[model samples]
Target chain A: GIQVEQSPPDLILQEGANSTLRCNFSDSVNNLQWFHQNPWGQLINLFYIPSGTKQNGRLSATTVATERYSLLYISSSQTTDSGVYFCAVESRNSGNTPLVFGKGTRLSVIA
Target chain B: GAGVSQSPRYKVAKRGQDVALRCDPISGHVSLFWYQQALGQGPEFLTYFQNEAQLDKSGLPSDRFFAERPEGSVSTLKIQRTQQEDSAVYLCASSRRQGNTEAFFGQGTRLTVV
Candidate 1:
């Protein structure tokens, strides 16, 4: 099994501020996804970046597969962005294996 | 449906009781997954099915948890003799492909065992 580690266990940011969260994995991965679990317990998909970079509105993600790391960036954040951010991945050995998730980065964007 | 749907958004069960959570994945999706999320924690993998066949269940915490997707479209997660430790949100997700696509998730079933 691969080990996923997310940095900045907790973060508090003022609305309109920019922030970045990181995820490091112990092994190579074929699939990587970023998810946002809002205050209401609904998990929203943010990105499915296995490699390279992708931008969606104020949120963007970059995965450097060779480095076994992924980065998520949020700009001009809003209070609605407050929630737990998770990074999950599946390795090359994944056959029927489900995604392995990191502990998560708890973000609180205060209005 | 446009997205995955889960039934009985919330449930409160007495210890030793059994509970079943249901999930309806999007049409044409081939992969379905069940995950358990404890308070203040990320979702943990429980089991996975590729269509109607359960491919892996290595993440199931114990024998008390079982899941099935007989028709390959809807799935159910059943926990028998529930314990307090089993209290958590059960999440269901489905992807268009088996292991290489984005997974759409349901809101999840919140279970509280007393």
Candidate 2:
């Protein structure tokens, strides 16, 4: 079993500000995804970056697989961004494995 | 369906009662998974199905919890003699493939065992 640790268990930011969340894994992973769980509890897919960088609107993520760390960036944050952000991954050597999730970082953006 | 669909968004069960949760994955998706999320925690895997065959179920917390996907498109998770600790949000997700693919999740079913 691999370990996934998310930083800043809780975060609060003013609207229009920027923030970065980090996730560190214990081993090599073939699948890495960032998700935003809204107030209604829907897990919205943010990015599927096992490596490299990807940007989606005010959200972006980068995963440095070699170092076993990933970063999620939210810019010009809005109140709607308030929720929990999760990072999940599966080991590269584990065949057809389910993604293991981090404890998640709760983000709150206030106007 | 455009996405995974879970039935009975919320359920309240008395202790010792049996309950079943249903998941309808996106049509043609090959991999279906069940996860349990406790309050203030991330989702934990319960079982996984690659088509009609269940390849992994090591995450199941107890023998009382069972899941099956007979035809491979829809799956059901059954919990027998539920206890208070069984209260959690059950999430269902599906991926296009069994490996190296992104998973789409349903809204989830919140179960409260009293």
**Top DockQ model:** 2
State the DockQ, from 0 to 1, for candidate 2: 0.92
Query: Which candidate number would show the highest lDDT if scored against the true structure?
Result: 2
lDDT for each residue of candidate 2 in B4-112, tens digit (9 for 90 to 100): 9999899999999999999999999999999999999999999999999999999999999999999989999999999999999999999999878999999999999
lDDT, each prediction: 0.94, 0.96
Candidate by candidate, in order, the iRMS in Å equals: 0.8, 0.6
Question: Candidate 1 docking category?
Answer: high
Residue A7 local lDDT, model 2: 98
Cα-based lDDT at residue B58, candidate 1 = 87
Going through the candidates in order, their DockQ values are 0.88, 0.92
Worst 10 residues of 2 chain A by lDDT: A90-99
- Screening candidate 1 with a backbone cut-off below 3 angstroms (N, C-alpha, C), the clashing residue pairs are none
Q: Model 1 over residues A40-78: C-alpha lDDT tens digits?
A: 899999999989999999999999999999999999999
